[model samples]
Target: MKGFKEFLLRGNVVELAVAVVIGAAFTNLVNTFVKGVINPIVGAFGTKDLASYTSCLKGPCETGPAGEVTSGVLILWGSVLSAALQFLITALVVYFVLIVPMNRMAARRKSLAEEAVEAEAKEVKLLTEIRDALVAPLR
Candidate 1:
């Protein structure tokens, strides 16, 4: 129980939970955008629904009243295309909004840490020189 409480309270655990919720919400927004905006744009060429676009691989391809495939093989290329577009949009947004900024911040922190180390090393060297000079005069 104690271990479980600790794990739940951990910074990363809470962050991960928040990230998951945000990601799910983002996914819905992307899906809605693709369906509302992208589909209509593509629909100008043909059907409004991308999933309705299909290639019949065999003879006598048929669909029921509900658009279910009744017979023959169908390559749902449009649905695949829609999914691909969604994935691309998600990846692009995540890369730019999250990954890029995080990488830049990490680089900044690393440079700052290096500068601190360099400054400390210089200070130590100067102190050593001063100590040596004082000892040489005493001898």
Candidate 2:
């Protein structure tokens, strides 16, 4: 129970939970944008949804009264295209808006930390030399 509590309170765990929530919210916004804006543009071309575009490979495709597929092998390339476009947009936004900036920030911090370590090492070396000089004179 104690270990579980500590794990839950860990920085990474907390940050991950926050990130999941934010990501879900962002995805919803993007989906809305695609549906409201992109879908309409696609509709102007032919169909309202990219999923409606399909090709039958086998027997004649039949649809029920409600437009549900009754029988046939349908290659729904339109839905695939729409999904691919959405994924591409999401990846580009994540890379440019979040991942790239975060990576750059991390690199900057690491460089500063390395410089500080080097400075500390030089100070330690100087102190050791001073101590050796004083002890040698006494000897």
Choose the strongest candidate by TM-score.
1
Those runs of model 2 whose alpha carbons end farther than 4 Å from true positions after fitting are: 1-14, 41-48, 129-139
Extract clashing residue pairs from model 1.
Answer: none
> What's the TM-score of every candidate structure?
0.88, 0.75
User: Clashes in candidate 1: how many?
Assistant: 0
> Candidate 1 lDDT, tens digit per residue, 95-125?
9999999999999999999999999999999
State in Å the error of residue 49, model 2. Answer: 2.3
What are the lDDT figures for the candidates, one per model?
0.95, 0.91
For candidate 1, the per-residue lDDT at 115 reads 100
Relative to the true structure, candidate 2 reaches a TM of 0.75
Encode model 2's per-residue lDDT on 1-139: one tens digit a residue: 9999999999999999999999999888888877788888999989888888899978999989998889997789998888887888789899999999999999999999999999999999999999999999899
